[model samples]
Target: MTYPQDPYGQQQPYGQQPPYGQPYQQPGYGQPGYGYGPAMPPQDQGLAIAALVVSIASLVVCTGLLSVIGVIMGHIAHSKAKRGEAGGQGMALAAIIIGYIGVAIIVGLVLVFVIVGIATDWDFD
Candidate 1:
């Protein structure tokens, strides 16, 4: 018995491109590569990271001064991120929150000390 031939028997020869549309255009070497989807945002800035570090350290050191500085830096980084001048918005926000908490803790401790000193009638020379 004779076998039937396959449909669309157009076989491309060696080293020959198939009958298709335009070829894929790739980005040049050393050029920024992009995906088929929308472009991604830039990487986070250093100031935001620094703010986070300082705010976290403030809690360990129990110093309100570092907390204040961290809060300031966080604000700056947050603003820049909002304007698209930098990234790390989340980190900056976290830093701000941590800094505020640190400041509150310090203030609460001071109040407690004062209250205890008054209640016990402690005298210092």
Candidate 2:
């Protein structure tokens, strides 16, 4: 007995092509893959805002030393965040602002104290 040569002869109706492409021609990679992958959210915005608030507050409260320290930290944080290294931008900015405020307050207070002391007369030999 002779066998039919067409492999798909029995499975498919005579004229139909394959449903998909050839096996070797993969339809992935480089082609738009499946769904959207993981992505990074916007960070550091909060940190920067926090830093600004703290720095301003520190200045008003007359904590010059603390404010200055905060200012430094804020700047560092901001730099890092900008570079996409780490978060805490707000904290860093706050520190810098606070530091400057503290310094100003301290200076002003010192001047007032000195002028008052000089103007007043106290007899102590």
Say which candidate scores most in TM-score: 1
- Per-residue lDDT for 18-112 in model 2, tens only? 35442222222344565668877756465566667667777677777667666766786789887987776556655676677677888899999
Candidate 1, residue 9: how far the Cα is off, in Å? 11
List candidate 2 stretches off by more than 4 Å. 1-35, 41-54, 88-91, 121-125
lDDT over C-alpha atoms for residue 99 of model 1: 97
Candidate 2 lDDT trough over 10 residues, lowest sum: 21-30
Q: Per-residue CA lDDT of candidate 1, range 42-101, in tens?
A: 676899999999999999999999999999999999999999999999999999999999
What's each prediction's TM-score?
A: 0.68, 0.50
Q: What lDDT does the true structure give each of the candidates? A: 0.84, 0.64
lDDT of 2: 0.64
lDDT of 2 at 19: 53
* Steric clashes per prediction: 0, 17
